[model samples]
Target: MTDQSTVHSVTYDLLRTLKLTTVFGNPGSTEQTFLQDFPEDFSYVLALQEASVIAMADAFAQVTGRPALVNVHSSAGMGNAVGNLVAASHANTPLIVTSGQQHRELVIGEPYLGNREATTLPKPWVKWSYEPARAEDVPEAFMRAYAEALQPPAGPVYLSIPMDDWNRPLSGFDRVRTVSHRVAPDPQRLRGFADRISASRRPALVFGPEVDRSGGWDAAIALAEKLSARVYGAPLPDRAAFPEDHRLFGGPLGMSVKTISDRLAGHDLVVVIGAEVFRYYPYVPGDYLPDGTALLQITGDPAAAAAARVGDSLLGDPGLAIELLLDLVAEGSTRTAPEPMARPRELPQTPNSPLTPPEVYAALSRVRPADAVIVNESTSTMAQQLEWLPTTRTGSFFATASGGIGWGTPAAVGVALGDRDRGVVRPVVGLIGDGSFQYSVQAIWTAAQHDLPIVYVVMRNHEYSILKSFAVLEQTPGVPGLDLPGLDIASVARGFGCRAVEVKSGEDLEREFTAALSAGTTTVIVVPTQPQKAML
Candidate 1:
């Protein structure tokens, strides 16, 4: 089956076999050669900037549950994509990132556009990085990157291919190769873990992003319900792992270590499924867990498991592990309910009045469809959204776990593409903050071009409200550039070719949102609001 032909044809055939026919990128001069005569079966998704390229790939991969191929320009473009790269790495999204290198002959001269040491740039963030030694090794590198990215603790990998490598004659890579995505736990360890679950008096289950990523949401819910375990989401979860409206759900844990330790104090056993034992922020020194409380984590990341601050870890396929645990626990597990946790309720909104986030989120709760997919980057308003618009569907809600901004806009567009590609016709809603919206504002144009039915709710508070909270918390006074003066989001959306409207009042917010949802096109609803002091 050796092609013994140009590397381009062989790689294209291999990519088609792997079903990685979609490529997202923002091309540059150096990348032109590789992109020339691109195959018809492969569709190229264009983004305005390199940063949006990675964010779009992030959501696309998560939604499809497969590795997404991303192409970017040379060194400068790679630099532009670093923020989103950090976010994707933090969430462990499987992305294969390739950047075009300058001409292979320009090695000693340090030519104008040449990236001398290309592999060093994206390191520590990407799982693997390389610039292939020979032109013929390009396809092999890509296939290896695919397997590396798809492996556990899956993260983005980088490949910097020289511009001329695309045309080199290749061989021995013509056959299709299967890639493995599942890892089963040791039978002895699984049984012991199940015994622990069955023996614990008051157990708690903390579901995480992988529950959505690995299709373990139902298994997580079943385990929680079977043992009357209170379900809490991992801190600042990137995906909704459990039904937020379910009786056993206790909401997301706090990012503060002491806060989390205090919340789960009474539970005798805390079993975290498909998430790290703890992901903390705003470092508050405290005990990792309550005294006498046992913490167990089941995850695919060996690094995370080895580095866990406290407790035991079981490595395996999360979906299968949960199923096994469910079967084992059923033999002898009793039920007991925990005390109900109080959730914040929405305040009543006055007619024709300026809307608050709580009011907008509440109205969204009332109007949001059961199957609508949400891409959230409304940082200051996240608490309100979490409180009012509780997500019930697994994989329905997506956010950045690394606290990166500018991800939602492009991610929404990419999720729309993913849905369309997978033949799922659900509405996509993007919740973006005014500050975050400005970062990747151009992403709106892609949605407009595709006429994707996405409703973008711009929470226009005109300030970096989260940074203001950070200023206060750190006692760093006189922080400049927190307030964004006189920037019109509606005008910006319109400039990007999206139908835009500014909603000043609660009534206007409700009515306009209802109209936008069924508008059959990409629309941006800018809801003006005053900054809320509700800091995390």
Candidate 2:
């Protein structure tokens, strides 16, 4: 006979059926009831803080190519996780975030841990948010959250669960019925796109992260080769979509439209795939395209295409659209190949006191694992790092596109969790700055708690280097609050239960990086950096 006290047993059974074995969270008193009767098969990851929890889940979702399950405490926890959720929304990572609330009955009278509008708190960040009406509906709410999170324009979803729901008896619970969506371009539309590409003399492909997420890399490559076209990655791509070493691959285009237009001036046809129309920094308005140039865009997002200034937009699944376009273009094609662009020029190494940032990146490139995942947050070293560590594979690199600091270190921990294999666990390295590291140093505790192996290479420049550089460029003297003085990052990492080291020279950097990679634990290596007058 089934015992009446085993109400949560069905909930656990449903969780298992949905294959949500890993739960990421930072627990609190309110969450204890929901965490009760935890199954042996399900593993709970304890994040040091709410931001790290959300960032880790975002990375996990990106790497696994599926929606990740996340949990957090009440109001405070949700507040902490907001920043990371915004970043995830911008990157289009599918995540399901759950938060514990006070009992439903107490919500009316301002209970100890009550959140009146818990679902509305994360507005504009989450694609959908809800609080189930009954305890029996909790599992079904999760189903809806998962589906909404994974739909087109994938992003994080939120669900608030009251503490009493877990303890309540279940009645008339039903299985969640899964829904599938098919979004493919019409055959006639694909043919029109192919005709445009085939008719053009000089065509180029601009690929983006959506292509990588949709598993359209091979199809993109085929399309590029079929047209013998040069391919450029979109400005500030959050993830890699094509191999950088391929002959057809041109380097990343800068964010400015002026810069992009200058680079694309020679080409007559520009085919943008799975990428934004154009993302810019500050105002530097100019012509949307070069003289007489035409644009064609194929994307999974209809809104993105509709918003583009100049383009023949085809809204559909990237893989299917590219495949059909290739089939259509197979009949007639011209072999007009443009002169190959020169390889990225290597930055000259300098022997300056308090090491240059590029030299540090060069040293990192030498010692880092060939297949390691890089999480970059060194704002001053943005141009230099990209030049030095050009990734050849998709999903091997990560960065915060929202320009928010403190994401690199925690995101690295999350990436390691999502991809753990035998022999040498894939090295997750953070190239972060001193000022940025201070913002999220607490994440080191999460790494230690989970025994997650990661190497944080802090560029210790001793100031808000980027801001200082900007001040210098403007010729402003005596800028207050730009200096970050006397903070020992290595000691802080060690205090948080991570191995730590400080590198004063190039020799020290090379030796310590090798040791950290093989140590098989979280390690922080601080490389003393110098302030550069110009952005590298």
Candidate 3:
């Protein structure tokens, strides 16, 4: 048992109250004092790199629907973790990220590991960042960090603690406080919003990552059905907010404004929920909406609302807003529900010589468990993956919201662990590209060590196919460094203590993937796939 008199003990007590017993980290010399005599009840998830640390914690927080604690070394470690921190912020994953600082007495002299500009380093990306003014304030700082990380538009928060502070005597104990996570929409505004939807002849609903993040799948479907609306997944969504197979469900929206406006042109009213007004790219020059259409957006993020180019914005918890709209909006309306967008025809089930991405995804879909979770970073083959392997369950799909590669591979590890801890364990399937896999390849060690049931399929296309697609889109020929030759992901996984294999044909992929699904330990299946240009 820890002594309650020390700052460490008191802080741990508060963590226990908050049920944040799972800590993800990579240790360093400066953090040793704080980690001394670690509590037996806490689970310490170790990652080989700080980048993987943040990604793992981000997925854990996303899976368990709770803020996750992350411990890193110092400034150098924080610098390494910044890339994934951007992903976590875009994903809006609530993370309490703490890093150790140099000894208080030596900090003034600029010791070797002192975090110069500690609070400024992780700025803009983090919701809040701070270092305790006094050693006694360390516990209080942590408490405040927890609150800030869990508030609306939840994102990662940072805290820097001096290595010497953990052993400092506690002046007194601080009481733990409960904080509300959701903000309800204004009653008057919501009533008007519902009225607008009810009056629309052809209404459309566009769902985003937040719908799935906020556990609003059922509410979203109900709201859509009540309005007899066509439902489309938001543009470039990081999570699957609707079941692709649902009759009312349309395919994902395009990333460019022109494409989106064209797709929703027929609809008289479009209601975008739980996402930014629009996440556009490639400078698609066009009107934000069609001539006969009106747009309304409900989002938890005020910034998203404010930055929206064309929309009547409402600030509230998107899920709750949808639920409330169900009550206010007229039901059993005579408006004709639009036909669902045509789904891609299923490819031939026969195995191929050099497997295609669609073929691989189809084979996996055939053998994949219904409840399995998919974390994908195979950017070039995303459209194929979504078509062949539809996500039917809530909270079953994860990807990087920042359009960054490398987060998915490590994220799958955390998803499996989080699912296991939450008592709803499901098989985790990682569809990772060869280039994306290499970004944080060391993460496989953490999964292997934990023996998480994750099947990592390395889609080896021997090049950065996504970049080549971009080159194609921009008409930029002869781009250098697009090819990624001589990468053996299977060999790397083996070195990391995972069950690894190389599959050449679709039959072998299906066979190995089926076996890996039931395997107790993590498996890496490296299958060489035909390169395909990505469609933006």
Compose the digit string of candidate 2's lDDT tens values, residues 1-536.
14674336666676677666789898987788878867799989887888888888888778777778888988989999898888898788888888889988888898887876898999988989999998878877887887898888788899999888887777634666665533788778888888888887888889888888787888888888888888998877777787776888877776666778887888888988888887665335677889989998888877788788787888887877887888787432466664565665455565666778877877877887888888888877777776677777667878875667777778887788888622335788888899989878898888877777788999888889888776765578898999889999999999999999998877789899889888878989998888755331
* lDDT for each residue of candidate 1 in 153-172, tens digit (9 for 90 to 100): 78999999888888777764
Could you tell me the lDDT of residue 308 within candidate 2? 89
Candidate 3, residues 396-494: lDDT per residue as tens digits? 899998888889989999898899888986789999999999999999999999999899999989999999988888899999999999887888899
- What are the RMSD figures for all models against the true structure? 2.2, 2.7, 1.5
Best by lDDT: 3
Candidate 3: misplaced stretches above 4 Å? 1-4, 346-352
Sorting all predicted structures by lDDT, with the top scorer first, yields 3, 1, 2
Candidate 3 or 1, higher TM-score: 3
On the 0 to 100 scale, the lDDT of residue 395 in model 3 is: 93
Tell me the TM-score of each prediction against the true structure.
Answer: 0.96, 0.92, 0.98
Estimate candidate 3's alpha-carbon lDDT, on a 0 to 1 scale: 0.90
**After superposing candidate 1, which stretches have Cα over 4 Å from the reference?**
1-4, 330-333, 349-353
